[model samples]
Target: MSVLELVEADFRAPTLIASVENTKPPATVVDSAEQLVDQVIKAVGKNIVLGAPLAIGKPISFVNAMYQRAKADPTINLRIETGITLEKPVGKSKIERNFLEPFVAREFDGVPDIDYILDLRAGKVPSNITISEFFFKAGSFMNSPQQQNYTSTNYTHAVRDLLDKGVNVIAQLVAKRTVNDVTTYSLCSNSDLALDLIPEMDKLKAQGMPLAVVGEVNTNMPFMRNHAEVANTEFDFILDGNSKPDHKDYSLFAAPHGSISAEDHLIGLYACSLLKDGGTLQVGIGSLSSALTYSTLVRHQNNRMYNSMLSDLNIYNKFPVCKSVGDSGKFDEGLYGCSELMVDGFMHLYKAGILKREVFEDLTIQTLINKKAISTDVSLATIRALLEHGAINETLTTDDVTYLKRFGIFKPYIKLVDGNIIAQQETASANLSATDTLEWLEKHALGEKLIGGVVIHGAFFIGPKDFYDDLNNLTDDDHRKFCMTSVNYVNDLYDHMLGNQQIKQAQRKHARFVNSGMMVTLDGSVISDALENGQVVSGVGGQYNFVAQSHQMRDSRSIIKIRATTFRNGKLKSNILFNYGHNTIPRQLRDIVITEYGIADLRGKPDHVVYTELIKIADSRFQQQLLADAKAAGKVAKDYQIPKEYANNTPEAIQQFYKKYTDQGLFGPFPFGCSFTDQELKLGKALKTLKAKTATTSGKIKAIANALQGPKLDHNTEILLKRIGLNKPASFEEKITQKLLIAELTK
Candidate 1:
């Protein structure tokens, strides 16, 4: 039997709400994905505009069932509008398949595939079904039709776009918690956009448009508190079988830490130097983010080593902007995380005691904290500042007492009635404006510390399995420090209705929004998400939003890190080009750019200054050509020559620098952790070499000839071959492949 058929008895679809419940109505529970899909179709009609969160929060079981139903019946027009539809990596060649398939199976055991993605990959997605994504998993869908339907909007604008696209249904994978017979759901990994989208959907429903919200409780998912926690009635329908026999419990998808190259470590070191203490931080995923996380830990946990490396590397003398814009001291005051994507690196930061700066939502408390007049611990000074800031009146009203008590500025035992402050109706102050009331308030009103303060305000979270475990293991107090909020709060300084603009500015002081770009032009513009000829390597997810936010904030700096050089199609190429056909971020928003060589301060600079500074941090091999191009374009002085210090900014120079610190036990390739073993690591390198050779005909021919001339393989070679199942060399092709692989592995 097919996996999707309902295991429970037949039941009719329940009526979905057309308006938001004034008081939450009980959700109708379902037993199977097929039954859920049937209810969704009945409630929302044939034209189902389904909205799902990006990444891990998607309920794939429901998604696949819906897609199958749509496929089976062409009359059902189903549109899956979301981002980052994660598909397991498929090998491009027979040899690559042998090298990677086993690893994929081991890593992604029991993970169900999205039926639409499988069909889309096979180029057989039915015309009735449309999959529109705002983002892709970076270079995962370069040439697919995903580029055509890519929603070109900022993260904050996703709700607006979804509304315009007529999204009538929202489905998510949620985590359920039970307390005293009461059950509630937490959005968990994806409170990001949905927190904002739900209110808009309610507005739509109020206008009599039919809509449904469905949730599938995934026991594997961690139940997050704060804004991610929602009442059970928020869902129109629910699927809450935690441990039924029919339920297929699969391993939650994991993003194992990738290998961070030596150059990437240097880039991270430079980038981390720009993050100030007690500031806000924003970082994305992958090796660079992991490198930054590792370096940040080094700065916090081992400041002596971090400082020594910086001074030895001549960072302050060479890139003085780091000292000016950021600092090289321990994060004694700590940092607050306000990011769109809460990657695994953030967990590393949190574990190292680096992510500890807590920001309160109360504008009065936050403003005072930002001004250094008060701390998270409420004091006499806090009351004084609140009075001075005109946030409160000397004559405390019942409203003022309630307001103060909400933030724990007032003790829990205290209450106000008829313009008098009382503690359990026994201790009373009749006149709050009197001089005696000041001392009375200080003695009775103050609490130990600020309540409801959060260290990390994230829109969504995606990481490895262990990362989730770390979250699940956090103490309730520690967990409360993290608030899984909406993109409006984390991604931008707009949304004044929520006091976001004013409060966020007070919270996010000296923010360093670190992101990655594929390339930067000589003029300082960056090409991050797309390639030339309009093929998007990835969608402009939240990079543009953060860049714009950086520009809007006085102290916040947008830091875009590039690897300086990339070996694409088996040839080394500069990521800092003279010009690029596409630009994700234009020159006007140009801020700080970092490469392995050094940091380039491009904010508020002339065109010549921007290009000149950028060239100094570029790879040495490409500097001359870039300089010549700038001269040809008249963007820089015609006679300007490369600086002697920067002229040696080659890969060999980086290697020497890397060697200097190797003995000091720093800059490991996989800084966080890795999925591969020692032998597998060696085999991974060999596979890369094989891939590079196989990229071009001439390269492949040369590789084959070198394999023919090379010495015969020994027992050591057999071990590597056996891992990829080429130990026996069953065919002529297999024999040639083994020889080629052996040549690379032994080298």
Candidate 2:
């Protein structure tokens, strides 16, 4: 929608006004975190059940102050409920620490540490302070003291869970903007739970329960418009970082991008192909998302290159699903994103003009657009469609006039009052059934087009610093296109507040919800969140929700991407196993699985067919063993033979095929851009290799001993050595580490 239309559409309905009047925010401002903490204690009491947003949207200083106050007074029982605690990496070994400490300080200079999370990591959280989360930062909290305090719930259910836990205080980070003495706030990085939680909290407060909805304002946060915007009155205690010293603005915690391997790139290509043009898209973080994003852009902007790669890989011939359900063609209609996490990928797509499929909030308009019965242009046909759909009556009411004006169906001067239609100079009958009245309205009242259409609807965002900057730099009009909303609205088709089932179905046509999984059993169960031991690798954040949602949305498909094989204890093993002890997605939910080698369409397939299809994409080295295991378990037919054409599903083969593009200066490690310096990148690769080679004690000693007698360091080696603080050996331990680095560099 045009930026101006967003303003025009802001006119609240009289019906909704009464319903939301009592639940509006207090809009009181506080000077500092300590002051806010004082207010919180007074409002909710010392037994503070604090609710915080996950990831970078957390207010670090405010949370720290709350924790410190609670710690200083054991009587104050503080329990923090949040997820994805982003802690700066601290290496385990001396050499690693030396390398990482300096690097971390440089990369994360202004990012404040979460004091309680740090203490929780050290197993030093006070007895009265309990920290818990429904999501983890992948493997971050596996061995932490609070690992047992995990909450297993879908993203859509977090608000319900938080309310049940009697969360009395909601401390959220927000972006503030003031215009002509009127100030407003944007949920910015996170609108996920708060959009659903705040109203419920207000209801509790109305019932005389002590509760506070606090906002910690940060100017560094991008002030996204549309759904993300909230009135200053919505927050009871706002620490305005813009004008307050105690709540001074700090740097956003940037989640740096990692290298996208060739395998991941291929997987992305396969997955994005299934993403139909003009459909809905949702993806998560990591190299796979980057790869998929890079390739999808290539497919849209440089179709020749993308098509050539697809043809060279013979994707259409081998994976029949790619031909039948997907296409190598460019996205002519673009896509709309509805994801829980708005990863940097969406930004890339948005910039490249691929994320431009606008969806509207009004069910009639959205359905008409979806059915191709009416376009965004509000012509005579749009009026006809609305009349036919019973969206408006022949005799216009005040509500009819408001609705028509809100959607820009009528010109600004056109108005309905006291039973008459005012059209500039001439008055007409309110009844559009009168031929002359309809003609006069169409000639002077109808507007040019629709407004308030948003291309992306996401719950939260976390990405590299560049992506954040781009978001902050967006023009007000462009910013409105990205609607940061609630997880329930973004991740489910069942949400009723935004629209009904028909409207949602129309908006999400041909949806492709792509997600990454760790493993897939031959029976088609997907293992993503944890291992066979039931240890939590990461929370099942929103993958399951989108996957399940795809089944309910029309013409939608759930594509699960997995690396064909992975290194477990330095041993290569097929990720597509015969069976797994745990599963996040059961066999019945299986649809499509993508790997570097191939795509496996598991939808509605029998056990034998599913087994063979999975085996077809498994690493060639383990295919025989996997097939045998499947046969032994009777999952596959005893007489089933591996297809000769698909027998060359090896990593080397995958690498060699991708080398064709990488050699041509395409498909680089960091497809979008690299965060690491050239020198840091070199050292990081060498360090990882050394760490792997020295996994055994004997191997480490032998390598160090060999390095002691090695030749002098070359100029490049010296430069890299200096980068990681090993240019000179200052101690006995440093001397040993220096030798190890020299050996790895030389090798």
Candidate 3:
């Protein structure tokens, strides 16, 4: 059958299919295993696709299954795909963690499933997983087939490419969905915008055709505010299956203590700088993203430090970003969110007193829009208002506006003016209530009109009860925001939102970045992929979108940060490796690459100059080697200078800094928020002490002494430690410290 027909069948299926239930493993395995196998599928070939619901460590079992299957059936091909990847926690037990078990197991298990597993850490490759691939999950590997690094940043180019490719079937995992008048699903790219596209199956469908859904199954799906859903029938086929397997208790990693990587921090700082005081910001979770947001928060909270930093950078002349969103971005007016990964970052923004809501109206309701309140079936006026306010400054021209008004925003009635509608009689029925109000606002209130309900429909799985509760109890206004149907329709709406002018601008920027990718170099020689040794650690996520969008935004810029070298197996190497077989962000599109050493100003610069700047940011340990390599390759001139000032910011310094704070007991693992019991905290501290003792060069005794005498270590604790390790005679002070430690552990 054709892809279109298959999609139709899936969307239109009348009966619910049998739901897959997880089988319990042997009791012995269950008791010993912190990580359990959710589903076991048999794949005969090396090339096998293990499909299941969203869960942690699905990758591990999938990999194992593929390897075993491939081993038994040697002729079968092997491939791996997962909805998400997890980070391994430090000093965590296998039984207590999910990622570490998979990782360490994978290492010991070896590459039995050859070919490739789509390394997310490094970005795009065939096989051979690298150590760098464990950073964090970005996007889904299931849709990697549809991911194309397009040259044009324009949404249309993306649309045109997909359309030309004749792709139609768009699969998404959503808690709930709706069928809009349009033929596509309205998937929220962020709070302010959505994408309507079909990537997998699109063939022989007449233009302006009414889309049909197939089979759909509904369960206890979490309903989230600030996001919307789609109808089950919106899909050509919906699988009416019960809930999939559960993968709860997924352990998360603790942030590394003491040594903060400067390169990551620099990138975050630069990105934060790009966000106008009130401009909407979309940041995922990671050291880099966290660093940027934290830096911004710290700057706003600490005026002295903020002033000093700005003065040192001589940015006093630049537009000072109002650390306050209301004062700066006018977020109180409303801000949009566009991101693939919806980390708690948005929550952070909301907690920080940003995240505003705004309502839109049609020209018919233009006057109401002026009043900052519009009750309409359409939202063009609101979008236009946002554009005027510089919230949507993506360069959509008049012609683009015309196109959107005609077909993009999808309003059935263009004749009805918003003002003429009687207060009691409205086109869209709003099932609003005080409960919904309280849930959405959650103490966050804006104007009478809560206009900031965001719609996001993608592969979703609600982990806990409380999380689900928060998502379900949204107001009527919040419900209208969701239009989950097909990925194609969602992407289409996104393009329409972009309109023509933005599309044109995106195209120009796209060509530039793509061409630059082609011209990317190794030793300064052009190479297609910049990834070292052609290894793909991670796939290209929405990097193209953000980069292209930044280029299209006249007032914004894209910044990429990579540490000069990563510490692995105890040694650090140049992050800007001499040659990479794989590349995520190429030099041509390399806008601002920041490292702890310094920033590499690559944009609009020649190869020679760019090479020198990049080398300057190379860590001191590897600067000489990198420059020598570049010079040998004739990428840099013989007299090319590597700034000396950039050197010597060693891990040792970071260690000292952390040690100073930790000795004082100020370098806490939970600096922001933590819910660990006091006993747990004491246990953790005791463990740290034990680890510190073992890590010291003089062995356990010396390390114990150093730790006990550290600034934060109690005065009594020093005597106790001396007694415990037999370094000094036991005394009253020692007795008191011992009692304290014991009490902490018991309590």
Q: What lDDT score is found at residue 504 in candidate 2?
A: 73
lDDT tens digits by residue: candidate 3, 126-154 = 33211112112332222333233212222
Error of 1 at 179 (Å): 2.1
What order do you get sorting by TM-score, best first?
2, 1, 3
| C-alpha local distance difference test of each model | 0.83, 0.83, 0.36
lDDT of 1 at 177: 79
Prediction 3 TM-score vs. true? 0.52
Q: What is the lDDT of candidate 2?
A: 0.83
Candidate 2 residues 1-747, lDDT tens each? 322233344355321111223446457787678888898888789989999999988988789999999889999999899989888888887667867887788778888888987787676888999988999998887655566899998888999999999899998889877665556678888888887887788789879999988899887888876667776666789886456455458888997779988899889888877877888888888999899999898899888988888888787888888777776777777898888889988988988889989888878888888889998888878878899999998788878888888777987677777899897887888897788877887888888877667888899999999999899889866875788887888888884565566777778888888899999998999999988887899989888988899888648899999999886775567898988899999888999998888899988888888989999988889899999999999887889899898899887887898898888777889877877777778889889987776766777887778888987789889988987778987999888777788877877
lDDT of 3: 0.36
Give the Å error, residue 622, model 1.
Answer: 0.9
Off by over 4 Å in 3: 1-221, 225-228, 235-267, 299-305, 310-335, 357-534, 631-648, 651-747
Identify the runs in model 2 with alpha carbons over 4 angstroms from their true place. Answer: 1-10, 13-25, 245-247, 418-420, 423-443, 697-711, 730-740
